[model samples]
Target: MILFRRRTLLLSFFVAMLVFSMYLMMSGNYPKVIYRDSGVPDAEKVSTEDSIDSTDIESVISTNGSGRDFFVEYRLERDRLRSQEADYLREIINNPNASQESKDKAQKDLIALAEKVEKEMNVENLIKAKGFEDAVIILSGDSANVIVRSEGLSTKEVAQITDIVTRTTGLSMDKITIVERSN
Candidate 1:
């Protein structure tokens, strides 16, 4: 009976993973995790010392407005996931054993990823080079969002961001959003 129980658990785990991988392949945003909120308090933060300096962490949790660090971390994570999706597509495209249909789809996905990555990187670079402390640019189908880390923004600051985005993207006024996060 113990042996049978072990076999059943392994089979269930395999089936669950197969379903997950299939779902990931079909989605354009391949791996933005879908989590149902369970009302359980996180134990990690609860037990941690409160005096740790945030700048030391470097990646996330920067000192300043919590919202600023939030956007920085979100953009970093989103780009990473998109990169992984691109890798998966590239593998399929390069696989000699892949079906022609699968190869064609992978090729298309690769092009899409390339264009998106280029735009995102260019926008972020231009924004940061233009004096923003840090910037994350998210371009959707028709519009773009520029999330910047700063100590809030003034009218001149907003105009500067808008002008830079318009010049860089050739996007009209309504198509660009400039968000300032204090940090």
Candidate 2:
């Protein structure tokens, strides 16, 4: 029947889009190089003056009162809220008293949420793999906002990020906004 064929076609289209987006994210055009400074010295023996206090190190590593901490906390909070939403949706789907229409809507919403999460993660990872220290992307209704860990972004960096977001979310370059958060 036409309806069955149409559904099949749509499913195929979505699958292809997913595959293409993943390919773009994993492409060798951008090399993956992670730069990390452990902040530890090579010398095992340390002078008393040279050794930093444990409390000082805790302050440095603590997620409180720091600019870089914002990203980690934000991600944790976002994930928590998303988990709550997903649980509610699952509840609605499982409730025997729920209307079929409501259950169907909840299922669609859950699927959409999953897709959005995937796209956001893909964009974030691609941006970081491109050499950013950290990045966060929120894909909301026709627009994406990207925050990167840097003092500022060069034109080329902006273009690369825009390309990743647009390709992953299928949004226009104009719909993507890139901002920097200095450490």
Q: Find the candidate with the highest lDDT and give its number.
A: 2
Per-residue lDDT over 54-156 for candidate 2, one digit per residue giving the tens place of the 0 to 100 score: 2322332343342335565445445555667767877897799999999879877767877777787788889889999888787667777787989888999
lDDT at position 141, candidate 1: 63
Where is model 1 poorest over a 10-residue stretch in terms of lDDT? 47-56
lDDT of each: 0.61, 0.67
TM-score of each: 0.56, 0.65
Q: Model 1 residue 118 lDDT? A: 60
Q: lDDT of candidate 1 vs native?
A: 0.61
**Taking the candidates one at a time, how many backbone clashes does each contain?**
0, 0
